[model samples]
Target chain A: SQQGEEDPQALSIQEGENATMNCSYKTSINNLQWYRQNSGRGLVHLILIRSNEREKHSGRLRVTLDTSKKSSSLLITASRAADTASYFCATDPFTDKLIFGTGTRLQVFP
Target chain B: EAGVAQSPRYKIIEKRQSVAFWCNPISGHATLYWYQQILGQGPKLLIQFQNNGVVDDSQLPKDRFSAERLKGVDSTLKIQPAKLEDSAVYLCASSLDIGAVAGANVLTFGAGSRLTVL
Candidate 1:
């Protein structure tokens, strides 16, 4: 079963714009990680924000975690055509299991 | 380091046919995982292994799906009597370990096996 839900089931934006999505989970988590999947390929880990961390940045990717609300958000700045893919949030709970959220499909047009 | 390897990038079979997918994780990674992803949805955890031992199989459909990691370095997922709903991409991933805390490890995934059942 999915651990959470990702808002904005689909989003379309022009290149150089920014895309943002939110995820909300049910249980307490050790960390929250975001992954990106290109069409017909496996997922690639984007960034991870530990429970104690409120925000983290890697390149154009910025992620924020609010443990109080059990929610996390991923922001991709200056999105490119190659950034078109599905973004999923996976929560690492105390049980050693990583359950992924529904996912947001982002399409960046040139 | 070589990333995770998976075979038969794609497969198509009719309902009730049996099929299998294989995975070889990066060297020395002690944890292996199998996830099923339906189109337009997130990947779902089917099973997880810590070394050669099964750590979790709560979401696996026992009636038709089974997996094994005999040597702890290689793994396989088999589906007998596949159903139409089983059509999805099966992904294999691995991590170094559980770490001092249970769920703190990051996973590296394979290209995935796309299964299409008619």
Candidate 2:
């Protein structure tokens, strides 16, 4: 079973616009990480937020985690055509393995 | 400084036939993982290894799938008598260490091997 589920399974936005995706998890987690995958490619790590952290930013990407609600969101600001990809939220429990969500597909039209 | 490496970027085989994929993690990485990703879904952990020792394989189909990471460097995943549902992408990833608190073993994944069981 998947530990996390991302909302807005598919999204489309023009370049330079902002795109947001939400994820809800069922279990407690030590950390939540967002990853991106170009179609037919392996995943690329985006950012990881620990349970103690609320928000973090990397370049044009911002991620927020609310442990109390067991939810998280990934926002890509000033999106570019290169940002077009499927985004996934992965939760790591107290153990080693990471359980992934269904993912959200974001399309950035140029 | 190289990234994870995987061979046979793509393969097509008939059902009931056996197939195998290989992976070589980034130099010096101590943790390795294998994941299965069916189209339209996220990747699922099939097995994890911490330097030649099995860490977790609870989700693996032990009856047909087998993996090994000897000497803690490279690894291989094999499926005997493949089934139609076995068609998917197999991803291999690695991290510097499983216990590095600062890093927490953030993974670096390979391009993956796409398999098709006809």
Candidate 3:
């Protein structure tokens, strides 16, 4: 079963604009991770944020987690056309298994 | 480092036919997973393995799907008498181990095998 659900099923923006995507989960998690998938391809791990940490940054990507609200958000700064892809948030709820969200399709127009 | 590898990037078969997919995880990785992703949906875990040992397969359709990772290395997923609904992308992923510790269980995924059952 899917534990997380991402908001804004689809979003389109021009190049250089910041894009923010939110994910909500139903239960407590040890960590939350974000992944990117290009059309007809496999998923690529972008970043991971542990429950103990509220936020983390990797290059142009920033991720924030809120265990109390069972939610997390991914921010892409100065988005480029290369950033066009589907983003998904996965949660490991006290288990080795990771449950993925439905994902948000991001389209960055050049 | 070379990433996980998968075979037969795409496949198409008729209902009731059998098909198999192969995966070779990163070197030394002890945990491997197979996930099924339908169109417009998230990838769902079908099974997980830890060094040739079954860790979890609660979601797998045992009647039609079977997977094996012999010798704790390469793995294969097979489906017999496939159904149209079974058509989807099969993703293979691996991790260092099944240790659930934060920041230590990141998974690396392969390019995935797209299956189309008619």
Clashes of each: 0, 0, 0
Candidate 3: residue pairs that collide: none
Q: Which clashing pairs does model 1 show?
A: none
Select the stronger candidate by lDDT from 2 and 3: 3
Q: Whose lDDT is greatest here?
A: 3
Full ranking by lDDT: 3, 1, 2
TM-score of chain B of each: 0.96, 0.97, 0.96
Question: Model 1 over residues A25-94: C-alpha lDDT tens digits?
Answer: 9999989999999988999999988999999999999999999999999999999999999999999887
lDDT of 3 at B113: 95
> lDDT (CA) for every model shown?
0.94, 0.93, 0.95
Interface RMSD of each candidate, angstroms, one decimal: 1.1, 1.4, 1.3
Sort by DockQ, best first: 1, 3, 2
- The C-alpha local distance difference test score for the whole of candidate 2 amounts to 0.93
Q: What C-alpha RMSD separates each model from the true structure?
A: 1.3, 0.9, 1.0
